[model samples]
Target: MAPGTILLVDDEENILQSLSRALKLEGYKVETSQNGSDALNLLKNQPIELMMIDVKMPQMNGLEVLSQAIKMHPDLPVIMMSGHGTIETAVKATRLGAYDFVEKPLTTEKLLLTIDNALRFKKLQDENKDLKDQIRERFHMIGKSKCMLELYDKILKIAPTSGRVFIFGENGTGKELVARAIHNNSTRKNRLFCKINCAAVPKELIESELFGHEKGSFTGASKTRKGKFEIADQGTLFLDEIGDMHLEMQAKLLRVLQEGEFERVGSSETTRIDVRIIVATNKNIRQEIEKGNFREDLYYRLNVIPFIVPSLRDHADDVPLLVEHFLKIVTSENGKQPMVASDKAIEILKQYQWPGNIRELKNIIERIVILFDSPNIDENHIIQVLPLDGHIKKTRFEGKKPLRDILRDVEKEVILLQLQRNNWHISQTAKDLALERSHLYKKMKQYNIDRGNNSY
Candidate 1:
């Protein structure tokens, strides 16, 4: 197969003919244009992997064509050639985005080498662009509910500022996603985005982990190291679960935020940094402050721009969209053809309380995609994958609630789920749950389940 298509533009017919023969003999498909106008037409009409243009052409000079071509396809690789080549002209071409400049009476060997290098560079550039697109897709938020739209607007307004952000939400509600969206849109986006989970890290080592440490600062301190703050200088540092941080460490962190500097463990030398701080927690920070678990001053300092990420249950209307998004992603990852959820399946998924929120939804979708071999997932598939009985442990099992109340809550959830699955047809729901029609009606009345939201 031909390696790639090459476009050669020159005013001289003989030069074009000779160059075309040389490139074709080396397994390249070549197109020749006698002037800049014809060359541009080729570029516009078809894909040209690379181009070699003479700098001195009639009507329109090679430089003019090069400029316009760059505008049309900014990443196109172009080489400038001229029998009357000058250092000044070569510099101008290079500055105009020419891949490389070659002089006329070009040696076949050198010409081939230049073309090879340019093709390799072009491949690398294309790969880099693809990788960035993949990253953006991976972190892309999928929702169109009113709450999500409002949150998106808030993120856009807050991203350009350098203010400290405090994001609050339940676990699995994507609080870290909010932080990431802010950092990716901020002025420091091109820099590092360092993150550390305050709750996951040990209290004894939290200080060193944040501020780094000097060699011999303590046992296992083998070498001098920089902390998240130092490494994230001029970027953004995400402190996840900041409410769980020790009070002493919170004081130290408060000082760093105030003075913009800190000393490494076992050293008194202060190191200053310019980092954007974004903190996230699933706990109620105000309650933490009132209970004396978190610092009130630090809470006020970091809460300059507060964000609340709504839990999945609050935006149940977006569940169908989220299901489709996860289905495509999971199927693609597993090298399988894309699958879709049936309407009934989606309805059952939406009715779920999602105590674990979006994270749980994604996990269940992945499990379904892997275990089931169907192109369309129906309600039975979801019922098989979801642990419907125990899915409410997180939402209904708070220690303060009595056992009787907890059982009652779980019973209500199960009955409601069954009702939704049966499309609120009371008889069908009663049969599915093996309950008498009168008993089901009594339970519905006790739980306030009504036909207002669904047809009976």
Candidate 2:
């Protein structure tokens, strides 16, 4: 079978016939045209993956034809041929969008190789485009509420700048989504958009993770490595859970922001990078500063463009739209029949306070799709999947309690909520909270929280 179709365009009949026969023998379906005008007609009318055209054609020459063909199909690869080949003519063909220029009498080996390379290059380009399309679709924001509209406006305004962005939002409220949207719209969209969870990395290794270390820099440094900052050069770097960074690391980060450079761990050589920083944290930055948990100078430096992503509970009206969107995505991914929710079921979802925000809501929709056999979901399905303690508990700010104590109370409530959602399964709850099982157990012990004592 022919690998792909190729169009052969030349004013000379013998050259066209010879090249057509050669390409046919090489497993390409070949079409021959004796003039530039006929070649352009064939290009417009046929599924030609590649075109080999002569520069010294009669009426409309190869360069002229190349320009029109490019306009017609910008991705089609064109090769120019001429027995009277000159650097001037070759350069003109190239500027006019010829993929390559070859002198005739063309070598079959070289011409075939060029055609094969062009086809492979086009295939790679198409695949890259398809992958990017899928990413854009997956990260797309779905909402038209007043808050969402305002967010969209802010993203558009900030996307064109090179400012440091500090996003304030709870976990699972899509802070990462906001960062990606900004990067995709920015001038550096073609470059990398690297990310690191500041809290996820161990404190001992966070510096190495950001600045990269030389070979044999430390105990387990097996090979030289480039860090997030180096990898994100000429691109955007998203730092999640910025408030959780230790004070010493914060000072190092401040130095990088101030000087646009850093020395990798155990190395004296400094590496400079041009990276746009975007940081996010669910913690209150001002409170962290007051408590001496975060650096004041670093906060000011990173807070150039602050965005407060509204919590899902604050925008309950968008619940119906969110539910429908998640339902379609989940059903399609799971190869299940399309599912819709009853009006009453949607109302119940809207009324419930989503402690875990949009992330929790998405999980419930997925659970319903996977566990239930019904094509249409009703209130019972929603109720069964929702956490038992669906209501948000009001945290009482006692005047006599210290600020730290009050913060602890809120943290305990959050842990308890996640535990109930996971049915007191420590491992699952720990995973949900982005904590190691041992750390979660320590928190449970610190709060004296026990499943037997507290009823969901």
Candidate 3:
């Protein structure tokens, strides 16, 4: 490993030479500066891990230098040294964010110990800032709709705790996105965030996938394998499409939730873990329990805190923002100059029923960016590229309709498209349309759309 870089600042040439030699001998990279300004300039040009500065210096005092250094690199640790050291000066240095102070006559052992502790603290702060940046990039949850604002508020409030989050939404409605937001905002953000698609795994393999498998446990089990639970210890584990999990697996899952312990496949030994569980399902788990497809106990265990992700159609006001964001991403990826969609094109997009929610919208924008060469893409360009299906038919009113009536028609069409995409699950349909279950039911009644209870 590379040695940690230390910037030593002192006006006394003899002291600088002596300390530089001793730190170098102790396996640290050292740089010397006679004055505060030169040290600040060096810090700007190069990455300085730590700074050791004499308290009394010409031109700029050591405390002023320390304050400026912190402004530039808050995580950088600075150790103040003084021959005329006093308790008041040490207290002042500490208040100014100095890591620690040393007497002028420094012993090699004492100096090395202080440097080690300061470097360790700086490393921890850097790691924490990097993790925060990663979370912001990955789980953006971009939107400004009223419903989106509410969801954001809920996530901020619940993320600090270890509460189990149950996300309810339709396929492609960004359920996984919400789960990630919670994980990234939680206290265990630095730890692993493991995910498993319960619906994607085969019924027989789910146990092995969640609780690891011993050697010779199954057909392909040549070696012992760690499972999602073990990998996510001290972090968060996201279980996607949980409502589709097999009834038998649900029983095992309930047991694990009740007691944070599970035995690996084909092994008698039990392992315990500390993991926060977050589950997402595009199905109505309550209805599944009623239909004997899900366990009541498991449902309750996972539903400690419920979060519903609204689909693109439900938040029509955000369509313009999403369109711009997609345009930026697609244009950058294609290495082309950015393009803008015309107002007419945006209006057409807002009116259309997004069957596949935000995912479909993203794909459509990418296709348009690649195929069309126009600077200003209009409604005609959109119509040409969009898939030809029952959802995109043009309509003309025989007579002038009220604005409210027109909007209601648009809402009805969008809801219908999402219902078809989600196979008519009311809970999933509501999430896709950004509506509450109660609100969707009222709208269904108003629109005279007859969906039987057996749709799920």
Candidate 4:
């Protein structure tokens, strides 16, 4: 295969021929353009990795072509060459975004070296851009609603401290994401982030999982093991589903929280740890404490820094963004081309109650990408997946409410549905709903709708 594609642009035929031979000899595919105008045409029509344009050309100068090309592909690499080279010309080329400046009477060796350097720099730039994109995907929270913005502010505030945090949310509301954001922003980001699901582990083995156990401590204890606390020493430990931890284990955990130390299952050797604990639970801790299933003292300690991750329904305006993000990720991971979610499909999604939250949204996207053959996922696809018995439409006619109250609910539903379908464009929504813009704004405030985000 050719090393890369290069476009050689110069008014001189002899210079073009020599340069083309040199590049092709080094296994590079070369395209020749006699003038800067043709060079710009090639750049717009095909993929050219690097371009070498003579500083002095007819109709269009090298600097003019460089400026236009950079505007089209800001990351592209371009070099300028001149036989009548001067210091002023080199500086002008640099300001015009030329990758390098090469004097005419080009030596084969020097020419190849400049090309190699330009390609290497471009590759490095592309790699850095991809790395930044991946970091954003991993750490950036995905919602733009009022609640999510508040949650982001809280994470930023708590991330630098060593305070114990208690995150409360419904299932699949991205609580783990909050915990990760906290750890990623903290000083101990380079250290371990240990997590264990309290509800998933058996009751008898929970202690061994949290605090280490010695060899032969129990029937299945074949070897000495380090628990999550030890592994996460000087790091962050995420306790998922903290409400399911046994009442007996809660006391032991409380002792560790208070003393910053714990003993192995079979050994009296106490180990001290400097772990920042961030625990999450879908259940209400107060209710758990009232039932005598959780320690009130432990609850108070963990609740020092409280966070609530809003459910998907609470921020329905964010549904379109979440849907598009999830679809791109799912389709790419499965080695398939990305599919589009139509506006009507997004409206249907925004109407959903999403008991399972973001997790359910992701699953639904992946399923559609796998099962549907069409590139455009429409409202019918969403309707097929969503449950028929839902609350939004169901709550409208409940309890034989008064006529005025029923009309208010109906108006709120109609306005919200229109706003969502328009991706929160206020003027367009009002026009589509046949309401004046001022009246629409008044109704939005009366219904307490804050059109703060989701501008698409």
Candidate 5:
């Protein structure tokens, strides 16, 4: 596909033909107009990536078009050209957001260079804007409850500091989101916010993953690698599920926290890094330390500034806001029109024990938005969409076709919920459910329970 469309406006037909041919040959889509009125019409009708307007045009000069275009498309890049160019006119065009001013004897090389630079600048502006939006969306703590307000106060107090934070909550209570909120609001916001799951990485590889590896470090180590600590240097490193890390890895991690240095795997040289540490776990730190699953020293080191994300039940009043927020996002992403959840539906959503917390709520909302095509979401629709927890066991029996069919659905849902709670770790899920790995695999296949790219 062409990179972008460039609109060329000039009273001179020769200039229009020449520029259009040049831009198109360079793999750009080009549109041409001989008058400012036609150029304005095209700008209003179609998306133009970059526009070149002749300043000395008949009927509505480039300056006038540029001024009006700024109101219509504030971010659009427009370059002005004039054979009768002047310092005053150039200054005026620049003030009106013209990308650049060019003389009418437009050099192909100079014009192309200006266009390239302007486009690149605009792209950077757009990317920065997008990053800001994502930061806002990812860290938005959607609640106005007193507890949430208190949590926000704490986040605002600690985010700008260089303190290490230890966040604890039940699974899916938005620990990761809390970590991101800290990073997004911190002094290191412009730098990287690297994350790694202590439970996700293999026991043997967790060290190399944190401290990096030299070429030929171990089996399949074909290239030198920079670990999360190095990549997140001068930024933040989030250690998720920190309680699940092996005891041996805990010692090495403690050393990094104390000394801020570690040698790469299979390399003698040590490297020092500056990273703000943020660790999170669903496990109780004191209990884990007593049981020898986690290190007491490491626990103390990470708990410099502790944060406990509130469970969804603790702030049930936020359900309406969260429902609205997720519904808007879900529908817009799915190319659907806005849908409103009834007030009673919101009240019913508040009555649930959200064991899986915000993540679970988001998944439930996404499923409902996709499955239910109706514009209005009522209590009946919500009761059907909510999880079949033991609280609503009778609801599951409603309108059942057959006893065997209901058992199959219950089996599938129970297994799926277990897998989701365990983050889709098949072995652990099977072990917890008291099933052999082989049996678990057979059942999963029978029920079409695919872990890959499947959301709970």
Candidate 6:
């Protein structure tokens, strides 16, 4: 490592020579100046890590020089030296950002220790800043709730290993965010983090998408293409909506998980790869397996490490923090002034059920922030901006209907509203209502809603 540079400023020639020799002998690059003006001038051109300045000087005094040096190099540590140093003077120097103050006839050992501590503090500050930047760049998991803290702790513990994580949550509950967090904090952070939406791909193309395809494999196959598994080799492959995958695809995926080898479509050549798999689904995999929609073997293999993400409704206490975070993000992006929510608005938000979880809350906050003209968002503003169902008008009557029936009615209404808003696209509507597609289909059938006429 390169030696740390130290600048010593004093009006006395003997003091400068003695300190310079001592510091040089201690393996530090030393520079000396007789006055504050010379020290400031040298500071502009020299890369000094620390400065020791005398409080009493002829031209520019030590305090003024310390102030100027801090403005030029904020991270540089300044230690004040004074023969007639008073308590008030030391306090004032500290207020002006001096790292430390030493009285006249300073002991070399104490001075060296102070310098070493200052350098270490600076290094720690730099490292913390870097970590914050990296966190901002990757996941937007915005929450300060106890649940979020626990989730963060889990990520720290599991990210360093080659564990196959099964993330379970409601739709839009940030399963992908959890997966990405694991990948970002893992040993393969530098490699690709690929995602495949199992429900979005057609049944016929699912095999080609997962295990690659040779040239002329099908009508549109003009050239060889790598699948998500190969693309995410040595990294993380996130299988989202895994419960929606076809039965045949599940069998093929099971084989890959068991053997770690696969043959491309229309090709006999088998390839092997080492991949860390992370599967996420809103659907209950055990239930799906019981229903014969999902493979039991695959479910067992992927359920090695299960992480359950809490819904926004479960952590209602964090709504205000999440609202503030979303408001700031939206206002900054739109170049608008900051806005605050009124107490009534907060109460209204807390009263409503957030079926869509964090993603829904974020979208609703952004919508309100963009449309409302008032600086203070009140209950009226929230009522007008959000959809009608956001504010429930009826209270439960136990004697009139069964609790389960009433709950089903409420769920059916919320699902219908979300379906209408999303133009009845099953996948999108399911996401907006925080339900799996199969679950939504079953609910629609139960409610006698026609999917053909309401199709997106």
TM-score-better candidate, 5 vs 6: 5
- State the number of backbone clashes in model 6: 0
Q: TM-scores for all candidates?
A: 0.73, 0.76, 0.66, 0.60, 0.64, 0.58
What does candidate 1's lDDT look like per residue over 1-456, in tens digits?
238999999999999999999999999999999988889999999999999999998899999999999998999999999999999999999999999999879889998999999999999999988987787787778899999999999999999999999999999998887888998888998788899999999999999999999999999999999999999999999999999999999999999999999999999999999999999999988899889999999999999999999999899899999999888889999998889988878877887789899999999999998998999998768866877664453645767989999889878878876776566789998998999999999998998888663221
Tell me the lDDT of model 5 at 275: 99
Per-model lDDT? 0.90, 0.88, 0.86, 0.87, 0.87, 0.85
Pairs with steric clashes in candidate 4: none
Tell me how far the alpha carbon of residue 425 in candidate 4 is from the true structure, in angstroms, after superposition.
Answer: 35
Give the clash count for model 4.
0
Q: Pick the candidate with the highest TM-score.
A: 2
Candidate 4 lDDT score relative to the true structure: 0.87
Which digits, one per residue and each the tens of the lDDT, describe model 5 over residues 85-193? 8999999999999989989787778878889988998898899889788767856779999999999899999999999999999998888888988998999988999
Off by over 4 Å in 2: 1-14, 20-48, 53-74, 80-103, 107-110, 391-456
Q: Cα deviation of 130 in candidate 5 (Å)?
A: 1.6
Q: For residues 1-456, what per-residue lDDT tens digits would candidate 6 score against the true structure?
A: 345999999999999988888789889999999988889899999888889999999988999999999999987889999999999999999999998999988778887787788778777877877876665554568777899999999999999999899999998889999999999899998788899999999999989999999999998999999999899999999999999999988889999999999999999999998899999999988888889999888888998889999987777778898788778878877788898898768876776677788888878888887787677887656665666565442444346788888888677656755665465678997887778899999999988776443311
Worst 10 residues of 1 by lDDT: 387-396
Tens digits of per-residue lDDT, candidate 4, 144-246, equal: 8998899888999989999999999999999999998999889998787889999999999999999989999999899999999999999999999999999
**In candidate 1, which residue pairs clash?**
none
Query: How does model 6 fare in lDDT?
Result: 0.85
lDDT of 3 by residue, 1-456 (tens): 246999999999999998999999989989999999999999999988999999999899899999999999877899999999999999999999999999988988888888988988888888888977865654577799999999999999999999999999877788888888888889998798899999899988999999999999889999999999999999999999998899888889999999999999999999999999999998988889899999888888889999888977788778898889888878987987788998867876876668788888888899999988876877656766665453442352336888787777767766655665465789987986788999998988887776442111
Q: Tell me the spans in candidate 5 whose CA falls farther than 4 Å from its real position.
A: 1-108, 388-456
Judged by lDDT relative to the true structure, which candidate is superior, 1 or 3? 1
- Which of 2 and 3 is the better model by TM-score? 2
Candidate 4, residue 312: the lDDT equals 88
